[model samples]
Target: MRLFPRAGPTASMVSATSIVVSGGIAVRGIGLLKLIYAAHVFGTSDAQDAFLEAFLLPSLLSDVLAAAVAPALIPALIRASTEGRTAGAVALYRAAFGAGLATTLVAALVLGLFFPFALPVLASGFGKEKSALTLRLLLVMLPLLPLTACNVLWRCILNAGNRFVLAALAPVATPLASLAVLYFGAARWGIQALAIGAVAGSAVEGILLAQGVYRLGYPLIPKLKGALNRLGPVLQQFGTILLSSVLFGCIPLIDNAMAAGLATGSLSVFGFGTKLATVILSLGPASIATGALPQLSRLAVVGDWRVMRGSLLHFGKLILLVTVPIVAVLMLFSGQLVRVVFQKGAFSTQAAYEVALVQRYSLLQVPLAVISALGFRLASSMAANELVIPAAGVGVAVAALADYQLRRILGVQGIALASVVTQLSVIATLGFLLKRRMSKQRLGVHTEAVPPGGDAL
Candidate 1:
């Protein structure tokens, strides 16, 4: 087998991974620009803190749910395709599209209605005006979660067909839209421009993805009839994965909320640093996982553990190859990177130094974070999400204690340290589960069963 396959599924794997990575860099570039622009505009101010938390709520919810639910749909998709029936796969897509669309809207509505109360928990340090602003901003951005959910589901359909380019590049729309808003409207509209940009951009991406899915012969309309029953196992797996997503997803909210009480600008500084660090750390692993999942799931379906293990190692190596040097640079010149990347307009010298420290602290977890991401993706391919919920629970429990203790001693950097600790705890738990799971990778296959006399989407 070629290390870099040129034909066959492995080749598609390599090709897709390549598109996702190269495309991811471009997308992240635009995202970094938005961060830089926002930093220039808001700096380490109360307003910036409020904006970050408000915006963050939607982003975290979108990613945690979108990323989890989409992959859960993948194995079932691949199984249906493997059985040589596009109708079965298309039905799964319909149920997923409708269910995701409806579920996220309900969630968004609940959160929007309660944001006034939730704002205190989301950012406890905010005073009356800041909380008021956050509530307003959040209402505008609340739709982002549902928009993102629908978009990712569309991407899921496209990717299931081995067509990934639109999805890979679609994210560019959000940041680009945000940047245009900031550049053109920030003077007049303030941070509200960013909120508008986020929703608008996601809607645009949805349009693009919808067209792609339609071009591939899938209907544009969502069908929820018999969705729960049709989505039996996928629905079951989604619940388990969503539970894990929520467990892990709440950490950032808590971390930022904790930072809010420390100092006027502590939350902003920590948010800035972590955003920069996480974007860097996750880029390689995220792309590799997205590109490789279908291939991994296919291999696991055939019980080819040996080649599956090889693919895992190769993918892991690819991550390290991209990350090690980046990590070294981040550690060594973090201060300079912070300065060059963000220190501008309102972002002061002191703020840059503090952010640099947080970056270094967050960097320590990169290796294990990378490993854990790969482990989780591999488990997802094998439909072993049950293990993830417990692992995430352990991590969240550890985060609560670690954040409480570390923040008392170290301030915002302590929260960064807490993240490293949390990742360590989660990876340890996952390692144990994967060891047991590997033995049953073949026999333990769990996918949505094609219902008898059904799949009439």
Candidate 2:
């Protein structure tokens, strides 16, 4: 709620925030353009809905696995590299890559095989034709799980080394490739082109990111044998991170599934609205979290709780300053914004109105979601990841109950409202837990100023 901290902003905080926000602006800008293109080409059709459904599993799996691995790995990698444990960092990277690859491949194979059975349950309201289309698209996109897993790991490797530019920019390839395909080929190939473009884009992103990591001298090899043993700390934290990620990730999945049972294009509308809100998230909270985590990790490792707390408060204020106004503007002009960005070609006026309503409700969660993300990053840095599990459980439970009660009353808009409510609940819980934990520790009692060279953290 406060825009300025008592101690003012530190150079390190500004530098970290600047790096991430600059790159994130590019990433989210390209991503927004891609969504605009998608809306133009696909609108809110059943085909679009089917494609959205098809993408749900792979995206969820990729995100969950990436989220689990990256948080645990980045902090460990930071610690290892800072301690001059190059060999240890390399082994950790390799082990994480190996484990992530194995898990992704196994998931893809198993899901592909059983998708026929699972599709009905996931999209219980889909007609036979739409269900078949979704299945085909899903099978084609299964490879993305592994590709995304590798890409995410590569980015983590880069981020740990403070190579933020390449790590942040590599993902731009996805939207870029997707945009090209949709612009040139959407008319010729239809929604299938969207799927094809997604797979291709993922491949490009993964390859380029992996190459970036390789150029930095870390090979993307699966050296699981000794690597796993070497990365035991990361592995130890992995389970808790994985559980939290899966729980948080399921909120979107649950929303999409619930949307599937609604009107034909409800899922697509929700997807579009959420994607727009996520741009705000990417530009601020997500970028800040990614940039801040390594530094926080270093601080936590050296028992610098006072500085860590200041850093947390500084980042929180930064998020509040950026997000509060953006949310206000978005809520005010949700209709006009949707119309200007997406109401064209295949997208209609009615569709824009529906999506604008969803976007308005969804945007309410942006600030809270940003704060919650910062909390998670801080918790992870301190290896207090287990704290996130109960928080995520609470968020997901509240979201589910809210969705169940509200969707019936408000239709698709209810789902978006539920997300905002869920995030508010989670942030309150996590903030209380983190504050209690910080207060119990002895490190915050002193008022010593951080060293002049604190910028390097």
Candidate 3:
């Protein structure tokens, strides 16, 4: 069909939404394959530990940069396009893209410089050979940061333009392409080849999504307009988003590091558990959100609070239906799942037990996980006083305090438990804020619907 959402029957919306969400599942599936491959190929050795450890910072950076740019781009672009202000809309897109690129470059440079010293502090027990390999791999991954940042901007622009299928499918190309590299190039060139392939995939994905955005009439020009006064609010909002995104992204990384500190193999176990948790909790919910965000922003832009509220509730119910079974299955069969999936070859039976234990703890947050995700995105779209920062701040505080308390008592398992606790606390806070927003939306609807009773202007 077409790239943009169109006026059609109810079936059309269902079909389109399914296509987008299915495309996300496809990409996520390939990503899972890549993860399993990496874990298998790298084994549970110290080199693998150091490699995963070194990847934490870069992965976190990639997430924060993308998160910072995406929410603003979506709402801003949707507003510009809906108002038919083509020039203003295109300018905003360009500005957001440029901002993401610049921010990522600066972060990479600073992080790369400090990575060597930081590695020792985090994983001092790791052997010197593995540490050196990790440091080198990290430096290579640094460039991927800017590429990933640019890709996220383009992907957000595409989604804002109602090209959800294209945006969702864009990620699949990277993993599929990397699967090729992982199988062939990795054997010949080693981890460096795998790193190169990843960067290449990022570049390709960015270009494809950027082209899709252009075709959909969102300009990719790198020009800026308007006064500093206008730019100030946008930048301020992004700063909060960036901070929140960094913390949201860093929690798993921090948990993994703490686990590794407790024991060498803990990082691998934590990584495997996280991948499984994200597959259940993050991937599907993210897909639905990606499809719905443009429509949600459209409703918000015109002050149609009833439709916006309905949208949130509809998606919330879906998340609940999907997550409950996942949490149940995970908790009931964590050991069996780990053993079946990762207990072959070098991964070992002992490794399976550790990962299963972590999975059991991590699975507790499943239901609230879905709720908090919707709450965060809904708050970001509302953009009133920019709520993402406060919500994210609560998460960071919870994670820090819980990590300190639990890491001492339970070791690796304690870190996972702390994560569950932090996630629940954030969900509680986000639930309150979402309720307040809904209340205001309801009041506004009643106020608008009532007659004026002969009041003077």
Candidate 4:
């Protein structure tokens, strides 16, 4: 028997895909279980809102720092390492780690000082006591910012080094750690336990990612120069990407926040629906997009326009293929889904209707949202040209304005509609931009290859 089985990039992709998809399933299962336990244990509108609100800034900040950098960092690092620029790859790691540490600390301080000011804006429906609890939770959760960002840096490095299985599986560590906090600590520590769980999860995730990086012969060090010089470009693009991600994300965030204010327990309803939608989006679309980044980057370097285009088309079709079925199921039996998932202990049938409404509306984004996420990742992976950001920003602005205008009139459902509309806008813009970039890459290849009107037949 051959000791080292013959394999190539294609085999790597197949194996990585299996690992990612399975990891997603595992994470999703943990998430479902946690939500069930939390609903039972916390069991109140206020408790749900407190946890969600405390989570809001940290979650969004993670998106801005870790996730924003993950796709961007992985492709660039892969290119650097493949081209024998080991120092450049190492420099990238150092820069990202420094940035994460600095950014997280700054964000934590800002949250500490300003969280009180923002609390009223976020949880306007809560009484002073509930609002204070929310604020306390925010302070506790803020520390996770730096911790989570470090986790992302390590994970991105590992993924770039083609250690996909560990990179994929590492995320599950956080949720499992959180489950322990909820199971044992919630009763004694109250909502603080949830916050502790998040922080502990971040620490575990960071350690796991760091261990994987070390195994791949990469060290975590602080390099100020590369981070400083290259950061301008990355940060500029990141700012736009952050805006786009936030704006797009703000749709549901605002919807959930607003609904929570309107009716008691409305927050939980919206949250339950959002989590369900996340299962589909994260497992299928996000997994594929993430899995494809390194390949896309390599294709860009080799000027493989045809393969890139075909890959993009495959991604779009893949999203539709997976999302259509999910949409059908959610549209047909949203209440049942919500009921089976929650609807016990503190959750009531009335809460189910509110959650069902959000879920049913979320079905509108089924195919569109999945395609948009793929488009964004695909565009970012193609040399980090930063085309997806402005287009996404435009969509977000549209969603925010629509959300504000429609929230009062249509309520939570309106918020969902706004989200759907913005996501469709993003899908359209990203699709067009991807085509244009592919054409440019093709034209550039043609111009460089054929010099002075000389053709050999």
Candidate 5:
């Protein structure tokens, strides 16, 4: 595939890409430092395992809310703005913000209340002490649900307006706060310090993003009037995307549950490895996809299918160019990477080796995972959000089965392999569906030539 247009990437695209990628790298760098600190301080102890498991619910809720809303919302906002319907766009944002806040509040309350009963089932392997500790940490973390949802909503709004830097950089505070708290208080407060740090971080992140949104001239005071009318289509699209997210989101929970059933430190090892892989993902595919979404949405609004097709293809090549080499290096030097990052203080050489094993398999999914992320965003931009759900469902089922069967043989490595297989399966199925849809639409046939040096924003 061609790496670039004959004239090369436009200045606007290059500028936007650089801003998003650099911001993402900075955020991930802070996160990596936090992880390294956590590894050194907590290692793979039961306290660490409890903290990781406790974090699962709140983090999953945040991701699901963000993923479900952002893709659908950004496109709608772009379309409305393009059509000079700024009032309608602002109203829609309010409605989404209000609805998301309410939903997060309700979910947090329900989860908090029910966690006492559900903790046993979710972490069945934990003893009474560990399980109780997890419950306490979870309750403290529950407030993060609403804070995170708002932060994500504001970030999406800023992104839709092409203000990528602030949106991307605002999240850096979360890790910074967490790292500081852990550094100063881990001895006195133990795992609970992490929880406190997370809540503090979420607060900072939300405030910074909210300020960014306001500075962009979007109203923070939500106007719910006419929001329902504008939200009808958005909600419909969100439902399909949310369903897909929930289906795929459960895979990690399932993996964690299975890991809990293994040895004492299995959950920590798996969590560490997964976090490392996510750092790579956020830096490349996730960053590229985020930068591309606004452009894709604008293109779709203008019926620029030919350009959209070309853009998608170009993105695929770009993502692979970055992801493939990183995956290779990580797989080949997994032990070295793990030791360099995690083997300190409480983290033992054996712990590093175990994490390395899982990291190697998890890194295998980086390229496929990136492609799948981009594909889903492209599909959402075209209002084909419902198309990938079946593929995701199938992938999740396969992952569960694989986790069950593989864990019996390879332990944590088996779980990691299952995740890789799931991503591959999902990407294959989704890519085929996307290609078939584009073929049917004849998107490859250029209908109108885009002007040279057109800005993607």
Candidate 6:
């Protein structure tokens, strides 16, 4: 019913949250290191853009698919586990894997085929040489499409079984592989090494995750018929989720596409600007919010308005208190942070200034994102998924329109501002819908026809 936890606790809550956040930071640190290394090698060149753009697409597509797939698949797995020694659950896992394999292949095939035709128009700002390089890197990296899609599938399956350690650490493969490439091959192979490493790292992640799932006893052996037969219920749950996932995930792509039409290095600037915000969210509030979900769900189930509102407010305040100062420091030291993190190699003084400017704007997302994370968990605990879908759609629309209007006057900084605008609108809308839903007092414990394992988290 709710977002997610460690024994519904205070000290344990902190412990659980700390572990989640710290682990995320540790894992992501490797990837961030890879990026820093790449920055040194590539700077804001066509090569870097080509690597980022090449990498961004399949990654984005896989993430969008994973976002919707995991949540929808969870409910189905829980239901299946109630059947017979998780026999149905295992069957469903196989089915999901099979279907994911089939579908991701089809999607990748279509994308690979259409990319050449579509690239000229979508990335019209790309010159002949730049576009050609992006195409090469993308094709080399495309096989990861299946690797990534499968990684998402297995990761969700493992999480459903309460096996998260591997899921968390497994992602390190991507960055680790990339780092190796950047270190050993950057001079010889240039960005092609980056592309190759990405595909290889994803493959490693896929292997490790598949192993974990099998050890958990859900081997994803391929079976088309099984997948087709079991697809109905999952598909039914998938439609709304797909829309929200697409909308929410589109913001970066929107920025990238819009930035493609701008000056040569805009894509990297936009990415670098937003990088610290990502670190802040993952290292702090997002982790707490995720680990803190189960407690909020408990309170929601009790349906005590005073307790619910008070607990929610307190948690939100605590999250903000911990983060706001960090946000302030980051804003103040944006330039210094950029210099320390990415100013070496081909990166220059002027590029750092421009990146810092955008970073100041993008850093605003930290507080807004945490608030939204907590709010979304609250909505989930209240079973208000319906409210979130349209809110996300509205956010995506706002992002596109704002980026267009702002990019003209403000350039890349305007694009960063547009993201902030989207978050503000979505959160405001979600807050309103959540308030109305809470007023209905419809969040009481569900004793009627409870599912076999009860509501997860």
Please name the candidate that would achieve the greatest TM-score relative to the true structure: 5
Residue 124, candidate 4: Cα error in Å is: 2.1
* Model 6 lDDT on a 0 to 1 scale: 0.75
Error of 3 at 220 (Å): 4.7
Off by over 4 Å in 4: 1-15, 230-240, 377-386, 431-457
Query: Model 6, 123-213: lDDT tens per residue?
Result: 6678889989999988998898888778988877766665657777787898898789779988898889998888888888889898998
Global local distance difference test of model 3: 0.69
RMSD list, candidates in order: 3.7, 4.2, 6.0, 5.8, 4.0, 4.1
TM-score of each: 0.92, 0.91, 0.86, 0.87, 0.92, 0.87
Candidate 4 residue 274 C-alpha distance from true site, Å:
1.6
Can you write out model 2's per-residue Cα lDDT over 1-457, one digit (the tens) per residue?
3455343334456566678788777877887887788887778888988899998888888877766776677877777778898987787788777877888899999999998998888888899999999998898889898888888889888887878888877787887887888788887988887788788898998888888898888987787676667767666677777788888888997898888889788898889877777678767666776777667767756767667766777777766876799789879998998899999998988888989999999888888887787787666444456778889999989988999889999999999999989998898888888777666554665333322112110
The models' CA-based lDDT, in order, is 0.79, 0.79, 0.69, 0.70, 0.80, 0.75
- State model 1's lDDT: 0.79
Decreasing lDDT order of the candidates: 5, 1, 2, 6, 4, 3
lDDT: which candidate is best? 5
Once model 4 is optimally superposed onto the true structure by TM-score, how far is the C-alpha of residue 172 displaced, in angstroms? 1.4
Instruction: Give the range where candidate 4 is weakest over 10 consecutive residues by summed lDDT.
Output: 448-457
lDDT digits (tens) for residues 1-457 of candidate 1 = 5556566555656678888877788888998999889889888887787788788878888878766766678768887888788998888889888888898999899888887877877677789998998888889998898888888888877777788888888888989998998899999999899888888889888898889989998998889899998988776666677787888887777787788878899988898888766786556656666787777657655656566666667667766777778888878988888999898999989999999999889887887778888777666544466778888889988988998899999988999999989998998898899777666654665333222211100
Question: Which 10-residue span in candidate 3 carries the lowest summed lDDT?
Answer: 448-457
Worst lDDT run of 10 residues, candidate 6, spans 448-457
Instruction: State the displacement of the C-alpha of residue 19, model 4, in Å, after optimal TM-score superposition.
Output: 2.2
Cα lDDT tens digits for candidate 3, 67-103: 5666545666677688898887776666666666676
Model 4 lDDT per residue over 231-336, tens place: 5544554555565566556655666567667766656666776677767777766676567666666665566645665655655564466569868977899888
